[model samples]
Target: MSLKSERRGIHVDQSELLCKKGCGYYGNSAWQGYCSKCWREEYQKARQKQIQEDWELAERLQREEEAAAYGSTAQAPPGAQPLTFSKFEEKKTNEKSRKVTTVKKFFGASRPGAKKVLGGKRRGDAPEAKSGSPSISRQVSLETDRVSKDFVEFLKPFQKPGQDLYKQCKIFLEHMHHKRELSIEEQSEYAQDFYQSVAEKLQTRWKVSPEKVEKAMDQVEKYVMTRLYKYVFCPETTEDEKKDLAVQRRIRALHWVTPQMLCVPVNEEIPEVSDVVVKAITDIIEMDSKRVPREKLCCVTSCSKHIFTAIRTSKEEPASADDFLPTLIYIVLKGNPPRLQSNLQYITRFCNPSRLMSGEDGYYFTNLCCAVAFIEKLDAQSLNLSQEEFDRYMSGQSGPSSSTSSSSLLPRGRESSCPEGSALALVRHNLEAVGQLSRRQERVEREARRLERDLIEWTEGLGREVRGLVQRCPLRLHPGTPASGTPAAPAVAIDSDNLEDPRLPPPLQPQVYAG
Candidate 1:
């Protein structure tokens, strides 16, 4: 045959072609086994299928493991994890441990010219450092169960980082939230909101004075500077931390306004709370307050002695300190600049006590106490006064009181127009009386002074008995040595004097349940 025809006609052996003993091939039955290439292809496909199946199985197993592990613990049982974030932490003990802690590891940070983590975090993902503000943000705290915005801000310096740093941070913080030392360059960490809030809580509840409230704020500041900064802690904590504990103290500083403005609601249990709390909510429902013109009303020297007094508080024992927010947000949302009374009221309530104010606060004639007193005195004089007197001295009709220019924005007052010589003379007289009494009382021991209050109480009792006995007879209490009491004992009576009573008697409701 020709060479090409011979090559084409050449045939291979069947056993050689099949190659069954060493390899596995599905269709090649000659060897009764398989070929190496066929076996490799089948093995690869089966391995891939098995891998996919294993992946599904592992995912299912992981879910089950999480369920079993978390069923009995509050460590967020799988699906319930995110729900925990939305729930209120009634008690701090119930909070879960965070997954990662801050540590003082030297990331390429301290190379001398190190900037704050200002550029390493992505803007979309991480919290931005608060810049562009040369003035400090105010801080205020409401209660034990709350965190003021100030506290959150205080945590900022420790948190601010650039995008790249933040992503690395989230990873570095992985599964080990224990404790971390942050490197803040001793910037201002004073929680302005927290301080203001604390002052408000104290003012409305205990009717503490602004100066005393400031003292409390100072106490709280010391606690934060010394204690909170000293160690790493859970984000949520009890009222026991020095800062927290000090702030939690119940005494409230208040405005020299009406009790309704500050002391109106006693506790949540008091049904009046719903009435008071419901007013704001219902006002939104009931009457739509219109945004009236920004009338140029003459400036008034209205103010509050403390933040809480400025807020219209509910009577609930644990007063809802957030009362100021809803009303404020409402006014802002409505695009209506609130009236001076409303504006000053909310502003005084919201402002951090330590941030903007100093010294004795001025009172509006509308101050419930002053109004009541004015009314009683008016009634005592006659059945009624002319509308001019009512508008000039009673209610909130007057532009401002003589004592007002001494408070808030303006400090200059024309020292004239007191019944005796000038308003300053009157103020000086009252202040002098109070100052001498204060000095004399402060000279005694606390316990002895307390006994003196009891003595005053006894005298009050004796006087009451005498008055009752002589109600029908022409008898009276002789003005002899005035009964003395502890510095704090008269606080309640002093508060009682501030109520806005429509009748002739001084309103007797105690401002503070206990000093």
Candidate 2:
């Protein structure tokens, strides 16, 4: 069979590509068969464990080396040294051995009655691993179940009041899940109302403290949202996904906007500033990887802080809102974070209303929203550039060339017959001149600084040499009498004008003349 025919014959199942942890999200091979959120958690766990193991290994190696060196230095026979024992040392030794044994059991290495099964199947008579020791996934699942059960048990003291609230929340979630006709706005309003009602009940009926009421509300939100995330997030009923794509495309087109153009203080050439900018971009891009509203909001906050920090480092002063907003816009333009619109909408619709109303988080999120809006509606007027120039950039024809300028290419007082056809040729000519001028200015600045430094160094060296020459070969002059006992001649001052050429050096004064 032909290669094309063989390729067409292959079939792949979508279910096989689902997350191995059974989160219902599509999986990626690079993420080790998990979705982005799950992979992030797994990676953090693995990294932490790796660091701990590395530390332990280093300590072990150091101890072994110290022991070897000590043994070598102690050349006396074994019986020459007196044996000593202390209760503390014995206790420590026993504890160390116990820890080692526990670690082995935890890893299934020393588990009692554990058996290996053949062909990936358990034999009828084979013993099972202990329930206390489970795989990572199993442990996570068990921990989640434990937390849920504990929460239920905690609410049990509240009696029928908590049970009724819980049942109402479940019913509301079920109704929202099945009702495809409900808009996001309606659902959000309903959710907010339900949350407020729960909060009031917790405070009034249950007589819970104000402090505890917020915590109870948070738990309720988490419980409700965890179940509704798949249905509500980036649903097809809304235009969030389409807006995300549009914003992404717009950001990509504006990639030529440098930090200078945005009036942002960041300079990517500086190592510190570059690192901060990169981190800001990374955090912004990670916003969509999160599944929860609060987590997404946190990502925005983190990204904004990084941008602000970069601005502060670049300017060497605390950045104001003006500086922060521009820098954030520049970061978004550079990052082109995925699902920008969807993530924003998700946070707006699902995050707590109080959080979005007032607070530091709200302020930063509002700025981000403004930055995205500005980017989406960007034009020639917004950038302080001509329409022709903006269009040329958007069309990817803003490179330097040796052709005629844009103005000259067009007829006087009239538009060109074929604007698009002539745009590349005309725009390139103007851009070429601007590019050359900018490069020349940069080169001049660099040369000027170099010349200034060299001049300062040369002048210092000349001063030092002159001082040394004067000290080595001193000229003695008597103010009242001449050495020859003749009448002292008046000191002569050299006139600069007496030089033949204006650029020539003036005559030197007589050194031995009487004062």
Candidate 3:
């Protein structure tokens, strides 16, 4: 059975997934739901419109500045007529008429005798006069322009070699552009060969060192690829886009797969772990936004770092490939990044071979590809679930059992049916509850300690007060002993004499009553 047939009942809105332009191509969120071609067209049109508006604005501002300056320096010429609104309007109209006439003459120069009438020289044939103000083209800005300028400055001393290199690259690009028969692979091979030849020339012909040659090659790649991105990336001749759509559909269908199912140790309940996981997801999704292979590779590395951080946060140990790969797969499933296949293919086909063959970027990119592959071929055995269970989940008849606890975490009336949502809700709710309980426990312990301290302080104070009172008025063990440190006098022999003086009548009365 086909893979599509196995993933039955996984429904996605066709309109939502397809290009908004109705071009029968898959859409990407990075392009605002348009295919790459449509996106590029829209972007160019918008940019052109913006440039026109900016030019008009700048012209208006310059005119206003000039007018203000003239007004500030107000002093009519000695013989000049007094200016009036009517005269100003008439003068403006006359100037506009003169401009119209000039334009007509310039355009009509193609006609016979028109050039002779305009001094026998076409405007195109004459050298353009340098102006104090910058040209419209110069006013237009691009990020790559700065890089190009820096490169030019770097090549200033080697003008001949630079021009040769530029001419070669331009010719090569033009040839590739016109040669419609060349396949994408053949074009890529040609590009690679050209790059290698250029590097050799920089070293052998120009005597550039190997280290500088690498930098120069980087600049060259950037210059070439920037111009060729639209042509080379997801070209109509390739099935990379179709593979992208397939992977997207598959990932959407498998949205129910959870960390538990994948054995990915991502505990979103921990704040640190959750943040790292989110960063990783963001990095993966942002890969589509970058146009360069190096930039996309950097995104992969960033995502890998985040994944490792998440694993460390959850497991409290160093993460290995065994831990890293499953987590990456889980991240991919969660992120469902747009144009996954096309981006990977672009990087593989065009990225500097040396950069991809070695280094941390290469390793992370390979793991990412493996993760994507694992996801594409995922089945019951891959997830360690029974075939019947997998089918039920795929058909939307069942969800992962691990998500059941997540239901209780949802709000009373606002439960999510999506397994991923349920799982995240569970983590968020459990984390909040744990945090609350932890705070309460801490408060209780704090209050207990405070009460214990107060009791100890009160007991100590009471003991001190009692000791002070004892010291101030010492208790006499015997009536003969004094509080002062003095020797006790001899005890009196007739204690009855002292007692009988006050109690003699009482004793006689008690004896008569007892008898």
lDDT of 3 by residue, 271-322 (tens): 9888888999999999998766777888999999999999888889887666
Error of 2 at 512 (Å): 78
Alpha-carbon runs more than 4 Å astray in model 3: 1-141, 144-147, 153-164, 203-210, 403-515
Q: How would you encode candidate 2's per-residue C-alpha lDDT over 418-464 as one tens digit per residue? A: 34545664565557778999999999999999999999999999999
Alpha carbon lDDT of each predicted model: 0.33, 0.65, 0.68
lDDT: the better of candidates 1 and 2: 2
Clash list (residue pairs), candidate 3: none
TM for candidate 2 is: 0.49
Best by TM-score: 3
Give the worst 10-residue stretch by lDDT in candidate 1. 290-299
What value does the lDDT take at residue 316 in candidate 2? Answer: 85
Q: What's the best-to-worst order under TM-score?
A: 3, 2, 1
Candidate 1 lDDT over 76-172, as tens digits, reads 5556543242233322213222321112111112223223344543122222234223232121112211333344433344343222222332342
Q: What is the lDDT of residue 161 in candidate 2?
A: 73
lDDT of 3: 0.68
